[model samples]
Target chain A: MKRWLPSSLLSGMLFVLWLLLNQSLDPAHLLLGTVLAVVAPLLARTLMQPIGYPRLAKPIILIRLLGMALVEIVHSAITVSRLILFPKPDGMNSQFIKIPLDLRNPYGLALLSCLINSTPGTVWVEILPNRHELVLHVFDLHSEQWWVDTIKTRYEKPIIDIFHEEVHKENPP
Target chain B: MNEMETIPLWAAALLVSLLILGGSIILIGALGLMRLPDFYQRIHGPAITVTLGAGCVLIASMLYFTVLQSRLVLHELLITVFVLMTAPIVSMLIIRAAVYRDLRARKRDSGVESGGIYRFPEQE
Candidate 1:
């Protein structure tokens, strides 16, 4: 099973995506999709680095995090639109702010970055080298502390919980 | 044209609203690009279009095709997934490039000096 489906989830998604793109359930398409799904992941596996696979310990938490991110995306989209439409006389306090991150797992960090960048008014600029801090650009800055607190508690905590093993392995406690 | 008449009233209403909403959001995002002062702020404008605007348009497409063809046409979801997956990476790369360029030139708003990420020549 492992040999046939190196990553079952990936294969499943690929197959579904193939079917959707073709917009067909014909046997020929089904066969082709199945073959493509199996082959694609195998090809990808070779190109990928030997980073440890992200084990999602708490699927529910991951889902909740994604849900929260969607809401945030919508909320910020509106806020950004408002700011754009009605610019303040003095101009918006757009600035770059750094947030210290506790979630060290690469997958968690990747997800967090994706969530932050997807939401309007926040851009993931870069992760500062030699420190576990993320440099982000905020479209409108009101309170730096609020951004830091929100990112640490709301986003990072859940991600840490979801990717618990990696953190535990690194910390050894 | 004949197929257009087949779409139910409720579906038509919903589709029209979604398209209008999506169009307006995208328009605002474009306007934001023109109005914003700096590179960082300008980058955000497209983020809204990529997330909410594209999402609305894709959903509207899904609804229209589903109602017209009388089948579950969800291929638009693939576009959504691809867009969501790729947009951040693109923005991240662009922002990184902008930061690198700004820092090299020692621009005031680059945040390199004040951000403490990189030390300037004078600071060194």
Candidate 2:
């Protein structure tokens, strides 16, 4: 299975995306999509690093994480818009917060970075190589500890479950 | 096109409202870029527009197209997905460069005679 489908999730996503993009269930389209989905991953497999196995404990957990992340994204957009619209430079402390990452998987780290960046106010700045530490810049930095706790608990934990071994997770989400 | 008038009143209302909300959110974000004092703070504005505002606009488009054509017209979602994937990368690179430039400038300004360095300054 691993030999044939080096990246099952990627292949599946590519297949679905192909279908979605073409928007046709015709046999020809299906055949083409299947071929592309199979061949593309195979061709691109060498380029991708061999991560042991992308962990997805449960679909429900991932759905819940995405749902929570979506809500936070919306809420932060509103909060950031308000902060931007109402100028209060003195009160707003835009600063970078460094976090020591327990989640080390490449896929997991990418997802976490996307979540952090997409949510209006927070941007993942730099990650120290060799050391599992990340620097994130927050638009409204009221408390450093709060940002640390939120990123670790709310985002990183779920990601670790989604991509790392269950036993390895610091705080199981 | 006559297709505009043919769209149901409720669908039109929903479409218009979503587009308006998305546009206004983007506008607010642009305003943030203008109003923000520092470079770090200014980046937040575009972040709002890309994630939430683009999402809203894309959702509205999906609604409009699907209702008008009467099929699962969700290919437009590709834009949202693409934007979601790309926004962070662009920002990350820009910020990395900014930080790099800022650090070198700081080192230069302080008149520190440092050896050849080829690494990102650790954010502490």
TM-score per candidate for chain A alone: 0.89, 0.87
lDDT tens per residue, model 2, B1-124: 8877778899999998999999999899888888776677788888888888888899998999899888889898778789989998999888878767777766653311222222232332
Strongest candidate by TM-score = 1
> Candidate 1: where are CA atoms >4 Å away?
A166-173, B107-124
Error of 1 at A144 (Å): 0.7
Candidate 2 ranges beyond 4 A from true positions? A89-91, A166-173, B108-124
Candidate 1 residue pairs in backbone clash: none
Least accurate stretch of 10 residues (summed lDDT) in model 1 chain B? B115-124
lDDT for position B84 in model 1: 97
The DockQ value obtained for model 2 is 0.50
Q: Report the lDDT of model 2 for residue B78.
A: 77
DockQ of 1: 0.60
